[model samples]
Target: MPEPIRTFRHFRDVPDSAWRWGNFSPAEIACRGTGQLKLHPEALDKLQALRDRLGKPLIVRSAYRSPEHNRAVGGAKASKHMDGTAFDIAMANHDPAAFEATARAVGFLGFGYYPRSGFMHIDLGPARTWGERFPVRAVPFALEVPAARETLAESRTMKGAGAAGVATVGAAGVEVAQGVLAEAQGAVLPLIPYLDSLRWIFIALALAGIAVAIWARVDDWRRGMQ
Candidate 1:
């Protein structure tokens, strides 16, 4: 037996458990002008099945219009929307031909193409089609690359560069100190050898950091080319 059509004054009146379709909400199918909702379970079932098959969002433009809202919107006298069995879906994220094929497979018998408005209407009424087909797109919308989350602290090249910069500054400061200490303080003469050793260590660290930075740059370039 066919599921009986149900009506609600507002989408909020719908019980949470009664809303079984995972991809659709009662609010989405409510009358745009009045907030009233009429539900046809089999129609929604077909719609949900279509959504599941497409594996993408179905952007509903209009659905479940109240009789008054339908008339105000200049809908056909016997529009399926008043019966809660029609939906106007945006085509911005869909390829019309593929979408139509899938809609048919999911038991949507009515199709009204509004290419100028960028939406297509599908219904569970008698089989029919209307209006111009969408112009062929060179490509459907492509998924974007995920964002990178690497921070400066996590970059090995940056770490090496920081180490090198700190070492270079430390070595220069030590040299200046040695010059002043040697000329003014004969008591601290033994510290000069240790300071000389530290200067060489800093120079070595700076060179090592430069090598790491060069390696990192090359690796980045190679990966980008790939």
Candidate 2:
């Protein structure tokens, strides 16, 4: 016997994404309705709180799912959404990062900000998040070269050139490469400060342990001499 999913009547207006909804399998529906989703009641509370705090509907673009629904949407195999602990939401024409910040302030877990997708993914499980905001630029195709004129006069340097009229062109090629590199560095920057703090903390702990060991040895020697 378990508690039912705490559903807010106001949230009924929110859209349900691709889930089987009323057609969900018995087992799946039971899982979502139970306390197995630890934050079943809390999810409803936070959803309403977000709506009030943001002064918008804060539409739920997706919600609890069955395994079949999960497979159809290409969801991660271990998604919390299936258990009624996760929800995807979007505010009409709102910046996802700003909206996600709002969600984080409310102490909701799993706020994934996907700006391009125009929505944020949230869950009531672990306090963690991950999602890309911007578009992904791919390597550009090379430009074609015009035929070289063999009969035209050329400079000495032109004669020895490896290829004729095949020089690289346009800012796009350079821009895409830099964009990817910058994205990678931006991703790593968040971890660096935490890592530095840990390094200093580990060193301090090591020194403290060494001092304690020396004091213990000194006490042992004194007791033996007594």
Candidate 3:
């Protein structure tokens, strides 16, 4: 015998525009740049419970992706986004561990931590977890590297000109070089102390940006292993 489809009685009386969880509006939980939404009643109920427990505003970073959108964003084949049972929340004002615990207590089982992206993924899917802690936000090191190198090069050129001892030009060049070097050092000085700790993260981000195709393949392989 076929099982009867269970219907949520509360959702029947509520309009889509009025559908909301605590601290989250229907518009906020909809897909980015689209009005489409398909939030599961149970998921919303659980999330509302979580919000009540936390007593803070929750920002929905992503929710209810279409299958095409999911694939475009490299979501898993069976991702909960397609069914509207998943959402990603911003971590700006919430403690990750506490948030995860609250979500778990409220019935979310799927978890994914994207420290590099400064967000966490939660879903009402089968019990499982993935990803690592994001202790700090990913630095814009790629952008900074070129600027630092350019400054260093300019300082070197100024120093070389000053060393040539060309009277007025030499004295002026020396002064300019000292100022440039000082400024450049000031910009890069803070990064030096944490170089060892951030080395792997920097390398990984660099490789991912430089070789997208390779990174995609490697990422797929890595996810498969997990």
Candidate 4:
């Protein structure tokens, strides 16, 4: 048999209106677990503080979801909610964006503001966090490449003019050119200082060989005379 799933009660005990404004179904209720929705003790304390500071009845849309429940609800492949350390929340005033900003400032992890759903999701693991709605629209690729390249280039020419013309470029080209220049300079730098030394060494060796040959020739001539 599979390992038993985990759950919480504080989130489960919440009234139906809190989750979906009276639209919650039995399936949604049974989705996470069968208990008064509970959370990690530290998470509960911070949540209570958030409620107190916000001065409103904080609605917990989801405290914890069982693996089966998480799968049914179209949760992310790796959801913190399944571990009883994450929750989706909303307040009586229902300002999702505002709530999300405030929650993030309070050091909550994984704050997602859902304007359409009228709630903000919060997590309590790492103080590091993120915000924004899910399924964000993809950015244009053209804008991405040049933006990335600008920081890497030593210097670059901007082609095109006025508001009507635009040109594209990348960092790889500039980086390659810079690297070639660097290598060429490196190869030539060491040779410049050693040129005089090499010339002197060659001339001295030539003189030494010439002197040895002349001495041998003189000795041979004397022997011949005797």
Given candidate 3, what's the lDDT at residue 28?
A: 62
Model 4 over residues 20-99: C-alpha lDDT tens digits?
A: 22222323333344443433445555666666666556767787677777787898878887766677875445455456
Write candidate 3's Cα lDDT for 112-172 as tens digits: 9998788899998799999997664344222223323335445434444433334434345
- Per-model C-alpha lDDT, please? 0.91, 0.56, 0.67, 0.53
Candidate 3's displacement at residue 65, Å, is: 0.7
- Full candidate order by TM-score, most accurate first: 1, 3, 2, 4
Q: Which candidate gets the maximum lDDT versus the true structure? A: 1
Q: Write the per-residue lDDT of candidate 1 for residues 95-125, one digit (tens) a residue.
A: 9988999999989999999999999999997
Which model, 2 or 4, shows the larger TM-score?
2
lDDT of 4 at 117: 74
TM-score of each: 0.68, 0.42, 0.52, 0.41
Candidate 1 ranges with C-alpha deviation above 4 Å: 143-226
State the lDDT at 93 in candidate 3.
77
- Stronger candidate by lDDT (3 vs 4): 3
lDDT (tens digit, per residue) of candidate 2 on 1-226: 5545543323332335412233222232232333122226456556667667766455566667667767877889999887667777764545555566777787677877676667778877598878776343253323458756444245333332312212222223334444455567576556555544554554555455555556655775786699
Number of the top TM-score candidate:
1
Counting only residues 3 or more apart in sequence or on different chains, how many pairs clash (N, Cα, C under 3 Å) in candidate 4? 11
Candidate 3 wrong stretches, greater than 4 Å: 1-22, 136-226
Model 2, C-alpha of 105: deviation from truth (Å)? 1.9
